[model samples]
Structures are given as C-alpha cells and as structure tokens.
Target chain A: MFKNGKCIFIAFILSLLATPIMVAAEYGDVLINNYSDEAGMRPVVFPHWFHRIRFRCKVCHADLGFKMEAGGNQINMLKIIDGEYCGACHNGEVAWAVENCDICHTGKPGQPTQVHQSTASKLTTTTKRKQAESVE
Target chain B: MKFKHSLYILPLSLSFALLAAEPSWRTLVEDGLHDPTSPAIGVLQEPASALSLLPPDTTGNQVSWIRALREGYIEPRTNILPETKIEVLDMDIIMEKTGELSLVMFPHKPHTEWLDCANCHDKIFVEKVDANPINMFAILSGEYCGQCHGAVAFPLTECNRCHSVARSSFTGKPGVQPISVSD
Candidate 1:
C-alpha cells in the first residue's frame, strides 16, 4: 500500500509539471482572450516576433495605432473587415486575408491576453538590501 | 548572341517578380501609396525605402529600429497626419514600492518622443501618481510596464535601466513621489 501511494504521488507531481507546458506559448506569443471565450472561440495567440520580422516598432504602434497592451484594442470581426487595426494589412492586400479562422485565434481557451515571456519576474530577481528612506 | 541571352534573363526575372500578387505591403500599409519593390524591382530598387534598409538583426527582428533611430539612420514620422502637432513632455516619477530592490525611476522624455500621452495615460497607468497597483507579478502578467517593455521596447532583461537610482544617493526629485503599499 505504501509503495502504491508513493507511486501515485509521483504521478500527480509529474502531471502538474506537464500542465503548464501542454499549451505553453513561446517567448513572444501573446495570448489574447478577452472576447474569445464568450464567443466560443479560442484566444488569439499573436506571435509578436513573427510580425517583428519585417516591420519596425512605429509601423504598427505609431502609424497603425495599436495600443501596447494585450486586448488593448477593441478587435473584432466587424472592425477587422472594415479596415482598422489588423484589417489594415491583413485585409487581403499587403498580407494574407483572414479567411482561415484558425490563423490568429488559436490559443488555449480562457487564457487572458498576455506576453508569454514578460519582464515581471525578471524585474524582481534582485533581492533588495534596504528600503529607501521615506520623505516627510 | 550574348546580348540576346541577357535580354532573356531580364524579362524572365521581371515575370517572376510581377507574377506575385500586388507589390509587397511593407511600406504600403504605412502610407497606402509607396510600393518600392514594384517598377523598380528590375533596377533592384530598395523596396520599402520608407523603412530603413539596414540589415535585419540576428537576435530580434531583422531590423534594429531603435538603434537605427538613435544613430540617426532613419527619420520616421511621429504621426500619420503631417500637420498634427506633437507635444513631448518631460517628467520623472519614482517608485519605492519594491521591497528590497532599487527604487524605479520612470521617465517620460524618451517615451513622449515616440508616443502620445493618451497611449498610456488613464489606460495602462493612471494619470494620478500612486493610484495604480504596480508590482512585478502584475507586470509579468502583461499589466503596467510589462505591456510594452517585454513586447516592443528594449525588453525586461535590462533591469538596471529602470531601477537605476540607489537608495542611498536618492535625494528625490521635485514634483515626484515614491510609490508604496498603502493609500
């Protein structure tokens, strides 16, 4: 009985480790899930590095008016077809048209739009020696 | 006979270039009119002349735009509208919310050079100082600074860039307050 319980514990721990990797995104994959879950569709996992391959930062952020945050822009099918945000380029003109539903929206369900490898934890890596003196 | 062979190559290559759907949109989407690859493809016109022609970087995107801009290789327009006025504000805010890590010094000079105030104000960060809840965990989840630092900007690996101020030498700047836990 003891050996069986130990084996079960080991199996449970292994499963826990595999869960994060099952649908893990790469470093620059941004999973956007604001409206996707409610609409019964998979969240869009935008490959930031892929787009960066050809364009500069200002091309999308400045000229195209894309907000920096995930789900920052009110992206939807109607707005996309009408020539806004992604539709500006993906509208069967410069790049491939959004005919295939699975192209952009292929993230796991219920994942909030976010960067796969963001700077959050890395920023806190260094332990503080002392807190700064408070100003009166 | 040699001249005839050369003539055959030119048309052959031109056909291949024109066979693809409309000229690439690298520079087209920005201004709807500039297609550098077309017409000039035969002459090997630097398509996307509007963009810097620098060789793509091996690490990040093929183009090192920040370096290109900083080194004055290219001049990108701040806005699509030519006549729109751009206001660049200079403000420095400090955050002491970090437990033991160095205090964060947030500056607006470089950011305003490229972005409008609305890009972050009241959206990513609250206009009123200390109103927003900021922490490394929230940022890792793509909140606050994480939205841009990891996505577009220089990235989060360069920690000292933001946490530059040493607690001992920090005399504090005017009009700036430190971020902390309580209201």
Candidate 2:
C-alpha cells in the first residue's frame, strides 16, 4: 500500500511538470482572467505570428512607439476603438474591425475561430506578400 | 549576586524603552527636516555647463538642442574607425575670465552615433547641475569628457584637436588646419 501511494505521488509531480509545456504550446491565444483579485478584466490573447507577417518591425515599434519590452503597451478598449494604438491598423482596413466584439472578446478559452477559414488564409497570404514588398 | 542581576534587568528595560520611543522621535525629526531636497537624497544635480556646449538658437528653428546636436551625424563608431574625412568648423565662445580660446569644433556626430545612451547620459552628465559636481580637474582625472576623449575616441596627445590656442598650438594641438574629407 505504501508503494502504491508513492507511485501516485510521483505521477502527480510528473503531471504538474507536463502542464506548463502544454500551456506554452498553445501560444496563439492567451487567457485574460480579469475577474481575479490580481487582475481586473479578461485579457485578450494577442497572436504575435499573425501581426509579424503583416507589419515591419519599424512600423509598430518605432512609429507606433510600442516599447521593446513585451506587454509594455498599456492598451485599453477605449483606445482601440479610437484608432490610436492597435486600432490604427486593425480597424477593418488592415485586419478585423474594432466594432466586432466577438472577433477579440470571443468567450472561448483559447484561439478564437477565424470566422471563415478561407478568408483567414487569404488575409494571411496577402499580408505576407505586403511584408515581402516592403522588405524589397 | 542579586545586585548584578538587577543591574542587567535595568539596562535591558532602558534599551527596550529607547527602542519603543524611536518611531515617534523619527517622525518628529522628519517633520522638522521637511524640505524638497530632504526627500530627494542622492539624486545628482544637473551640470550648469551641460547645455552651454550647444550651438546658439537660429530664428525659425524649432529643433531642440539635443536634436540639433544629433544632426549632420554619421553612423556611430564601432570596432574600426571608418577612414572618412570630416570638416571641423572653428568657433569661439567665452568659457571663463580672460578670452580662453580653444579648438571648439570636432567631428562629434560620427562618434555620437556609435555610442550607447548610457555611455554619456548619467556618467558624463549629472541629472541636474550642482548635483554632480564636475570641473576640469575631475575631467583630467578620467571623469566625464576625459573618460573617452583622451583614451578611446582620440588621444589627448594631439593638442590642436582640443586646445586650438595659438601659443599651445605646437605641443597641445597638432596637425594641419581643418580640411574636409570624402567618404
């Protein structure tokens, strides 16, 4: 009985170790738990790869004054709608419309559904093309 | 002995009383010492001459002194000093008593581009004047401008490079007159 209890304890430790790796793999979306005492609102998970393909480093970094440090930009919902920060480009013209609540605040736990997979893929491809043109 | 035991107890009680009284004493002292400088201990003073080195204001120019200093800049210096010739503009300014003239113009922009911000911001300049006391003596002792001017950028051995006075021209400042070089 003692041996069986030891094995169970070891298994529990192993599962704890594996959980963080699984969390990191799901990088495309982030969970914002705002209701907790530490943070006030649900944070929208931002996909880095999606934006990297669309813009140059200088555009959002140097021009937009986004800090070199990650999560350094103090963004709020009001700022986005005013087309100041992320709204400057993501305002329907470049990516998705700010008015579309479900696009960002999707009630899901992880990556939101891309509305239509066909249109999402086309957008990604066009963005990649524009990035290439700017580089050249 | 009973007397010795009582003596130890007495000193211990006194010490405890002093410890308990410390907070109120500290508050009283802080209230008495209230001043702007009291709150900002160890904050360095800005140098008076910090902005004196900059060029004079030209009409209709809205550029800040820092931006003007960065203008006409070349790439920052790295491992190897690029073999590009530069034009040195000669100008005069009164530093102190007795018209103490010197070779004021230098190829500053090229060197500035290569340097990191920290290289000069805190070390070379005090956040505020009179906060970090700097003088020619400190500079000669390997502080501020002397940190690199004589060591890495260019040797202070060249006299005319800094002190362009006619008398000290031979030993302190050397070489030909200001000549332009092409990339």
Candidate 3:
C-alpha cells in the first residue's frame, strides 16, 4: 500500500507538469478578430505553426509588415486580395487563396470547439464535427 | 494752442495704429499657411529633428535597444549569444502585472533582431497572451526576464524601461517613467 501511494504521488506531480505544456501549445496561435464579430463573421484562427514552418519569422513580420502581436497587424480581406497583408502569399498561385474563409475562421471564441481546423480534424469527435459544420 | 492739440492727436492716432499692427487671428493663420518654417508647423514644434533624438548608430535603425546595447555601446558581456540583423518592428505588448503597478511594454522588434525565436519561445516565455505571470518578484530571482536581463541584457534596475504603458491616473514614482530612446 505504501509503494502504491508513492507511485500515485509521483504520477500526480508528472500530470501537473504536463498541464502547462498542453496550454502552452496554443501560444502564438492567434484568433484574428480585428473586425470579424462586428461584421457578423467568425474570427480567424491563424496557425503560427502552419505559417512558421513554410516561412521565416521575417517574411511575414519584417518584409510583409506583420505586427508580432497577433491581430496587431491590420489584416483585412480586401488587403489580402490586393496582395498586402495575408494576400502577399495567399494569392491563388503561391498558397491557398484568401477566398477560403473557412480555413482560417474555424475557431469560436467561447466554445470548446475553438481549435484550428487542421488540428481539430485529428482531435476527438466534437472538434472534428465543429470543423465540418464551420465548412458547411 | 493749435500745435498742442495737433501733438496730442498725432500721438493718439499713432498708438491706435500700433495696436492694430499687432498680429490678429487672420494674420496668424495666413502666416502659418504661407511659412513652412513657422512655429505652427508640426515638424518644427519639436526643437530637435527626429533623427537627432536617437543615438548616432540607431538614427536610421528604427531604435532597437538590443542593437544599441551590443554594437552601439559595450558593457560586461553575457554568456548568451547576441542577435544579428537590423530588422525592427515597432510593436509593444502591454502586460498588466497588477492593477496597482504600471503595465509592462514588451517591445519585440529589437529582441528579435538579436535572438532567434527558439531562444525564449516555449522555454522562458510561452509566446501566448496572458500565459506568463511575470511578476517583479520572479524576475528579481532570475526567472522570466532575469533569464537574460540582469545576466547579459540591461539589468532590472531600469524599472521604467519595461513598465512604460501610459495611464492617465498614474502619477509615476521615481525611476518608473516611460522608456524614452534618447537616454
């Protein structure tokens, strides 16, 4: 019984350590809601992971003039279409077009379903359905 | 008697003329429009040119504190590697540690110029909003900011440099003023 209790205590400590990691994973992944709610549209889930892999931090931040603070950059659909903000690379030829709103606007602010569509698909049942519904 | 009256009348008329010659609102407006060098000009309002206000090396460098510390001036070097490149981004994250204390203004541009993303990301600071507690106590003991600040970067003694979010109600304590680049 003594050995079992010690093992349980160590397991508890390990779980506590893991909790922060889970939360930290979501960092830098921003919810771009500059004018989304005001315009009756969903806020965008701009995955830093997705973009960071393909491009250096300088590409979007320095050359493309993206503010480091998420949503700090003045991003608009019109600007993207004009090849200004997200439009710089999201033009049909370079990457996915800005017309694909559902890709970025996958997260809901208060709802538990507020994970990125790409990640949501891999997660359990509810988030996957949420992504599908958002597409629809 | 006629000469005395003429002298008094001449003086009174001249006085009125002088009073009228003093600049009117109309004249001031006209002067502002026509004269680019007028006191009313926006740029001229500041006595020194914008470039002159910054350090010589940082004049056109967009004011990176990290760069100024490393290359512009020398001090006791830290073990950590310094960042290269002159890239600057003029954005600040205002962190409200406590309602009583002033908020911290985290400027990223200069830091990014010096260090890689991995240096602090996920390790020291979890690149998320409202994630790190980042209190002064922890910082003093060598946690979040103490990771580099006291060790290599500017020491935490410079309190006002980070806690520089402007608040109307705040009557700042000594050494708690906003970080001005001129210093």
User: Which candidate wins on TM-score?
Assistant: 1
> Who wins the lDDT comparison?
1
Scored on chain A only, each candidate's TM-score is 0.72, 0.50, 0.60
Which tens-of-lDDT digit does each residue in A22-113 have in candidate 1? Answer: 22233455677879889997677676645554454445676678877677797898888887888878877677777866566555566656
Q: How far is candidate 3 from the true structure (C-alpha RMSD, Å)?
A: 31.0
For residues B1-183, write the lDDT of model 1, one tens digit per residue: 999999999999888887552223132212212122223223322234423365444222235554565566656556544554577766678887777777888877666766667677777888987788988777656678877776656566667778877777877652364443111
Interface RMSD of 2: 26.0
- Give the Cα lDDT of each candidate: 0.61, 0.39, 0.51
- TM-scores, all candidates, are 0.49, 0.27, 0.32
**Model 3 lDDT per residue over B83-120, tens place:** 43444444456666556656676777666654455556
Tell me the spans in candidate 2 whose CA falls farther than 4 Å from its real position. Answer: A1-21, A26-41, A106-136, B1-183
Sort all candidates by lDDT, best to worst.
1, 3, 2
lDDT of 3: 0.51
Worst 10 residues of 3 chain A by lDDT: A113-122
Native contacts retained, all candidates in order: 0.15, 0.00, 0.00
